[model samples]
Target chain A: MILTAAFFSAAIVAGTPLLFATLGEIITEKAGNLNLGVEGMMLMGAVMGFMVGLKTNSPFLAILAAAVAGGAGAFIYAFLTVTLRANQVVSGLTLTIFGTGFSGFIGKGLVGEIMTVDIRKFFAPVEVPLLSKIPIVGQVFFHQDMFVYLGYILAVLLGIYMYKTSKGLNLTAVGENPAAADVASISVSMYKYLHILLGGALCGLGGAYLSLVYVPAWQENITAGRGWIAVALVIFATWNPYKALFGSYLFGGLDIIGFRIQGSGLAVNQYFINMLPYLVTIIVLVTISFRKSKKNSPPAGLSVPYFREER
Target chain B: MKKQLSFLLVAALILSLVLAGCGGNKPAETPAEKDMVVGFIYVGPIGDGGYTFAHNEGRLHLEQELGVKTLYKENVAEEDQEVMNAVADMIDQGATVVFATSFGHMDGLEKASKEYPEVAFMHCSGFKMTENMGNYFGRMYQARYLSGIVAGLKTETNNIGYVGAFEIPEVVRGLNAFTLGVKSVNPEAVVNFKTTQTWYDPATEKEAAKALLDAGADVIAQHQDTAGPQQAAEEAGAFSIGYNTDMKAAAPGAYMTAPIWNWGPYYVTQVQAVIDGTWKAESYWGGMADEIVALAPLTELAPAEAAELIEAAKAKFISGETDVFVGPINDNEGNLKIAEGQKLTDEEMLSMDWYVEGVKK
Candidate 1:
């Protein structure tokens, strides 16, 4: 029973970062901008957050540094794809390369340095008073670190903002048909820049989570392609922040289930177990494609640059 | 006009990428004209805190001790073409000696050695050689065995979790020796083993460690890179045995000891040999006596008796007494793989693929 509880608890831990990154991508896509620089932005966030955490020994400053660094990366993407009319895909890929190299170069001195700050406890789990009285769900969900709680709050708030607000409807209109939204005076560029920066900030939070809360260490390429997984997760969640929450946990659960079962005297091949998360992602994508739910498809303007003159 | 502007931007981007790909970091101003330039190719970033970090430490030692100028290319994929490209790049930079520190670089180094006969090439943990190339690795299993004794004595739960990188002979050999060490001290203890199949993915490795903790293992031992497992054990309030380097700082509370490679002394010797014109193509597997492999100092987390126990076992390794893989052994399947009063020859140890008893995979 303890093992089962631990598994679910860990699932949330693993999923929190994914939830952040996926929601970031969803918000960006909804702004008619498909910023594939999630990986790069996260690295900037991870390194900056870790560096700040180490130097100032303050988690608050570190968190702020991570968000700003990630937003800075998105700012570059927005300038290239939005202002200069550069190809979104090419610019995003370049950002990934740049972020990878930049982090490595800056983080060279930090490689093996023992973190002096007790950042782990700063992000450690805090049990909710009333929720702690419940059963398995309480232990798994409510009794989590600050970062996990942040993920839950962010997901629900984003869900409400996207579906229940008039401003969100304008953002959706800008994504589905930017020309129509432009005709309605919605200011398409403003929405894209605003949300893309917001998206970048969230992705940075995800990266900070990996360095500060997950491994709590600075290593080169520390994200290890998790940013890419979060991108796929955006599609899996069909741009719904709430669904993205569950999707992130589902993927995170599968990621470590092999390890949990391997200790139980199971004969499962570990290599196959390691591939479980990616495999499930592919299967979900295939099943979703077959279902042909148009509502579940991507934002109409995703990856499409809007030019007023062309429209 | 806008079309022309965007076209120019795209062209500039592509050109910059191409330039970045070709540009290698130029080494510090060539040491006095007589200084020998050494080159290193690593399979992972030097920041890995494990395998590549140890190798980088060796390179630094080579620079400081011998005053030889050094250049390195890190995170080179273990592909023959990529290894060759890195080798070619180093050779282009006037490197007289090259070290390829990954098993997969063996073939590439073989071909490069033949192509550059005047240059000395050394491959780590591989079995390929040419006139200009040789192989070198430490008997890390010796240190592994000693640390295993520490884990065995320290664990209160009797459930020791081992995170393995791959099931190859090198890893398997270490796993067996460690389990044997555990069984020697505590026959009732079980070593729960799981492979992440990756050398240095922190998140994945940490999860694997957490899984072991959930399964009731109180002591975590890892044959993988990164301090991820150590961090996991520390978080769980469990003891940990590290590998490759001392990881006490990574997990101050959880860290017990680690089997570390002291490649600096050996690197100094090999590079000095090259300078003396006595370099030869031979496989060198140095043991504890050579100081190439040694155990990290046991921490307060280790049992008080662990220090004496480890020293007694380490003495045998230094004195050339009992080896870790002495016979009278059985594979996990209960098949007698070796007879009593016998020991595994170097050839047998090199090709070991089976697990010893009490190692649950």
Candidate 2:
């Protein structure tokens, strides 16, 4: 039981960045925009965050810099997709390639540099007075980081805002049929821009989490495909923010399982174990695709480019 | 229609010329009249400014010092089938010798050697070799052992740490050699090991270094590509030994010396062999005596005794009077692998997978 609790704790910490990115992506997709530049935005955020944090020796400012950098990257996507009406898939892939090369160019010198400021982990467990006394359940719920608690709260709050509010209905309507929504006086372009930037900010924060709170130093290619995993989580969640939290934790658990198994001196192929999370992600995506239930799903006009004459 | 047909005909003629240029065709010449063309395939980009850079420098030396014509493909992914095609292309282009500077490139080189029996293939850090293919690796563990002596002398906490790239035998042997060298001087020292499962993850290497430092280690050594551990050591006010290249600038205050591979002499010799038609299939594992494996100059911050100890060890190794993996060694788990007063054979060292005593697994 203790070992399980330890594993869960490690999983939550590891999955925090993925959860943030997935949740933000869910919001962006909700407004009918598909942003494949999450990985690019994340890399930019990581480099900017580390540079700022190293210079200022302040973790808060570093995170803010990361968000700003991410926002800037998203603005590029918005200008191409929402304004110019360019192909979303092509733009996203181009963004990823450009971001990867740009980040490497910018971060070449910072590769081996020691981080000057130590960013205190934002997810340290908080012990509630009354909840601390319970046995297994209390230990699991009460002893988690502030970010974990905030993630759950945000998920529930966003779920309510999307399903129960008139503003959310307008947003969903715009996503489903931009021509109809424009006729109904809803600005589809505005929603698309807002959601894309929001997604970018979230991805930036996730990237910063890797350098600051997780590894706590600057490194090239530090994200290591976490951005792609975040995209996969969005699909596994069926475009719902609430389910994304669970999905991220499941992936995180698989990652830690490999390390734990290797640590225990268990006779297992580390390569196969290392590949477990990626393989499981593919399986989850396939299952989600096979299940045709549309309880909470992608926006109807997700990947289609909108033009004035499209109607 | 006649004018259009003429234009098409001209375009076809130009296209054929371009294709011929890409095909690397030249007028047939006698072997004695042609300059020996040697090709090199690097796993990483030359701009990496580290491992691949060192190899590129060696290739440059072959061109400048030996006057050998060299061609190279940088940033070639190890698993890409294009590597084999590239090798074949080099051979077609009149390369007499080809060097594959990556472990994963071995199978590709082996396959190419079987297809082209006339060309000599030399692979770095690979176990398998064919009649035309030979393996070449430096005695990096010798330098690691010497660096460990400096770590042991400098550490105030009696705890030394090693950040390894992978758990492969090459890295494993380095870790064991370093631990043994540290124990030689500081008998009470304990070496902690952490594997990041990658050759170039700066973030993980930094984190692993911090973890070791936090656990009471004061001297850190790494078997990784980047200088992350060195930077981490400088930040934490711990001493560090670098790998592959001179990384003193990365962590000036905390920098000790690094065990760097000098490939220039070997490159010159191999190219000379090809020119003289005396190139033979042989594994070359040279150390400081041959100047293949060398220790970088000790930093100003290094302990006063470091230079003296390193000099003694260098002399002993050069004189063939001392083997780094001598007897009275024990595995990390406390199993006596070598009896007292018995020296470890070269075959045993080649297949060594166990750690010596005083190392934490």
Candidate 3:
């Protein structure tokens, strides 16, 4: 039971960034734009957040700066794909390259620079009042950092916005068949732009969480391709925000199992355990395809740039 | 629409030009046009805060000491095509010496050296080289052993853990030396190590460190690049040893000591040899005695006796009283590695894939 709780705690720490990126990407994909730039955006967000947090010593401002940086990246992609009709895949790839390069250029100066701030206490465990008295479950869920709590809240809010609201239906329609949505005067471009920007902002917040709370050290390319894992997580979650949270934590669990189960008399190869996340992603993708629910499929027009002039 | 297409094309062309410009920082000014231009191809960005950062520090030292114009391409992949292009570009940019600073970059460096015989080549931690090429690395294991003494004295659980970057001989050698130091000081302690299989993944490094913490290790050490392991140890209320640099700030409470590289002086010496036209293709391996690798200052978390213990060992290294790979050594499996009174040679140490008695991989 102790080991299990320890493992769950590790999962929360590992999964928070992935959850942020997956939910962010889900929103963009739901608006018919498949942004492959999450990795780039995350790096930009990480460095920008680190800079702000270090300079201002204000976590809130740092988080905000990261969001803006990420959104700025998305803004360029939106203008290229949505306004200029550039290919979505190409534009997204370009954004990734741009973000990675720009972040590295700026971060080179701060290399080997250490954060002397004692802001770790701010990100330290916050136990829920009263619920903390409970046993294993309480310790695992209620005792976590503010960023982990934010991940939960974001998933919940995103789920409601995706499934329960009228705006959600309109956005889904725009993604499914933009011409029909346009005929109904739904303003397809507005939804695409807004959702894409929102996605970018959320992705940025995810990166800020990494730099500000998780790891809490400055390293170049600190996202470490976890942004790509987050992108894969969107497919695993089947566009459901809540499922994305679960999937992210699942990857997180697989990530640490190699270490967690060590010296428990189990003789497992660490390399095979290390491959669990990607291997599980492939398996989940295949299983999702076998499902009969069409709702479980990707956004109908994802990666397609809509052209009003052609229609 | 045709106008829009042309406009888009123009935008893309401009963007490409800007990104291409960002790829290589302008080479520092050449005081004399005839001064040799040295180039570097780094495996990761200079801001990696780990291996690449250490190398760049050396390059900066080279520039300052030798006054040679230096050019470098950060984030160059060790993949054949990318490194080849980078090397070719550096040569075109008038580089007389190109240093490829990654083991994975060895094949690419070999190819580049063959193509440009006139241009001297240097690599870090690899064996293969041509007449105009040389490989240089410090005996980081010596420093690793000193840091291990810190961990051995500090750990209350008698369980030590290491987050190694890879299973290569260099890392293996460091881990063995560390285990030897640990057992030498605290015979009851054993060191368990796991590989992240990556040089610079902070997330995985932290998780691996945490996993070790959960496994009851009170002392954590890392061969990985980032300070992730140190930070993780601090968060878990455990002690840690860092690598590549002083990681005291990364984990103030947990950091005990670290094996650090002082590449600046080494770079000066190597470049000076080249300037004197005495450069050879011999593999150069310096140690603590030469000050190529040294132990970072012991953190306050280290035991009171730790400093004295580590310092005595340091004096032994400097005075030629101790060798890192000395006799009566046994493999982790209890098989005899070195006969009593017989110290292992540089050739044997360089190819070591086995662990010392106290190591559990």
lDDT of 1 by residue, B248-349 (tens): 889999999999989999889989999999988889999999999999988888999888888899898899988998889999999999999789998899
lDDT of each: 0.89, 0.78, 0.85
First chain TM-score for all predictions: 0.95, 0.88, 0.95
Tens digit of per-residue lDDT, candidate 2, span B229-264: 886787678989988878886778788888887888
Please, what is the TM-score per model?
Answer: 0.95, 0.74, 0.93
RMSD of each: 2.3, 7.6, 2.6
Q: Tens-digit lDDT track for model 3 on B287-352?
A: 888998999887678888978888899899889897878989999889999999999888888788
| Candidate 3 i-RMS | 1.9
What proportion of true contacts does candidate 2 retain?
Answer: 0.16
lDDT of 1: 0.89
Best by DockQ: 1
Q: For residues A164-221, write the lDDT of model 1, one tens digit per residue.
A: 9999999999999999999999999999999999999999999999999999999999
Give the alpha carbon lDDT tens digit for every residue of A1-311 in model 3.
Answer: 32678889888778999888888899999999999999888888888988888888877888889999999989989988898778988888888888887888777776666553656677788998988668977888889988899999999998999899999999999988898899999999999999999999888888877788887867777887888888888888889999998999988787777765655667887789867777877887788678856888888888888988778
Which scores higher on DockQ, 2 or 3?
3
Error of 3 at B94 (Å): 4.7
Model 2 error, position A26 (Å): 3.7
